[model samples]
Target chain A: MDFAPLLGKANFWAYFFIMLTGLYGMAVKRNLVKKIIGLGIFQTAIMLFYVSIGSKEGATIPILTAADAAGRGGIDAAAYINPLPHVLMLTAIVVSVATLGVALALTLRLWRRYGTLEEDEILARLRGDPGGEACTPRS
Target chain B: MIQEINAAILLLLMVCAVAALQVRDLMGAAILFGAYSFLMCLQWVSLGAVDVGFTEATIGAGVSSALFFAAIFRTTRRTKD
Candidate 1:
């Protein structure tokens, strides 16, 4: 085996595990906060995967140099990392932050609406009377 | 050489994921998830994805974790399990 191809393979597996962990947390955890955290993890894993795909071995930054500035076609760009993915990731990071801010704001509103943050407790309060002693499934 | 480094980062990521899952405390889990993101940034760096690593470190490890904690602060930290 050449073993060279395996160099970046670990990134793929790390992404996969991170994704699975996030998914598992999202699915199993009942707390709204936990769910949000899980979603964050999931998003992070995806970003990692996207970024890892653009990486190349022994590649320089994809920028034009003064020495190659006079060239008609552009710089001698051999072994240069892809710039497109970097640009895309920057956009994605901005979007993710915006969305997260909105989500946090919504969570605050939810807390204000109900005295408790627990999903079951909120549901009980929303159902009319939370003081009922009857044994009922929260959700 | 690169393979070994990648593998080490991968192992670190896996451990962080497991710790995030197995912890009984929700806050602890959120922090572990942040650590996982940090390791993942390193993994991306090893893969030559500097841009991705930068985003992961900032948004993933930084903003996302803060947002998650904020959301959690709005909700109950205790879990039935």
Candidate 2:
């Protein structure tokens, strides 16, 4: 019924869609590398949302120039955008990169040992299905 | 903050995310992901987050893409099914 409010927040919804796309890729894709790509997308969609909320219209970044500091009695806090979200997102980005690197390394190791990056094939070989070599199921 | 640029970047981001997932070549998808990250940094700068823009540019676009390329080169390139 009320489309105005919905349209006003188009940016948030767009990011939500991106997150959904990432989730779909992670959940449905059989390839380990593809899943890592999805994870990267998912992390960024959220970080983008955080950075946006910290910004303010008609306000500058949190840093203050010397001229503004020298001329004013103190300064209006409202003139600068919020810095907390940006700081938090910075930590988030670093952690996500570390996570991605470790994940890819694990994927590399999996590829080396199993000889395939596809999840199902890897599992099948682990279960000793093809060529009857690795696991040797005994029950 | 530039509202128009943010909107355009958001649209491009969504497209890139989907395309990166759908592409058959993992290396090509990694480059698309780099483009997505760079566009995201632009959005952050236009939103007045300069520090964030720089961080994303270096880490997301540069470092993460390099990681992906390394992973892809070490593993298979084409996907089946």
Candidate 3:
């Protein structure tokens, strides 16, 4: 099999690395805030991959520079990159922002009640560890 | 070439991600995350997704960073691990 083509697929490799890095941060990090950052990174990597896939090697931006819709002539759609991914990604970006905001708010509440942002400490407190026996789960 | 540019940006992005993950300071990690978003936005624009890139610039780099800093303000900046 010819493996040379894979070297040219920089976008694919970049996205793969970013996704794995994010996954590592989420799965291995002990801090709650770091996990949120990882989640954002993971989401951004997916969006980047989708956008890259929608691009064509010889295409221009999706917008038509001239008024071809004015009926003087028809616009050649092939000249422009596909617009569907861009539109879908707009909605995705908004959703990510909303989710980030909510997650941060929850993090704030957790910090306020527990006085720490470390996942292990929170779990310890929840389990009524000896040193954290004074801590009780808040309803 | 387009591939070279993408490779450079991707390298920088990975560096930022690693730094953000390893930093002991939460605020520093948030700032690095913002830089990561900007690099990703540039990659999107270079790949011909201007609309998606613009959205990422505003939401990922701008609003998200602001929210992270605000959240950091409410908590201690130092991480235990």
Query: Which predicted model would earn the best TM-score?
Result: 3
Q: CA lDDT, every prediction?
A: 0.72, 0.85, 0.86
Q: List the residue pairs that clash in candidate 2.
A: none
DockQ of each two-chain model = 0.51, 0.71, 0.81
Residue B20, candidate 1: how far off, in angstroms?
2.7
What is the TM-score of each predicted model, taking all chains together?
0.77, 0.88, 0.89
**Residue pairs in collision within model 3:** none
> How many clashing residue pairs, candidate 1?
0
Among residues 3 or more apart in sequence or in different chains, the pairs in candidate 1 whose N, CA or C atoms overlap within 3 Å are: none
Highest DockQ: which candidate?
3
- lDDT (10s digit) by residue, model 2, range B1-81: 356566778889899999999998888889999999999898788778899889999999999999999888888897742
Predicted candidate 1 versus true structure: per-residue lDDT over A35-136, tens digit per residue: 666676677677767777776778766766665555554575676787777778778767777876886687678888875545666666777767633335
Sort order, lDDT high to low: 3, 2, 1
Off by over 4 Å in 2: A1-8, A68-74, A131-139
B1-81 per-residue lDDT for model 3 (tens digits): 776787789889989988888899999999999999999889889888888888889989999999999999989898854
Candidate 2 fnat reads 0.69
Which residue segments of model 3 deviate by more than 4 Å? Answer: A1-7, A67-74, A130-139
**Candidate 3 C-alpha lDDT tens digits along A2-88:** 644874687788789889988998998889999999999888888878887888888888775555566643467978899898898
By TM-score rank, best first, the candidates go: 3, 2, 1
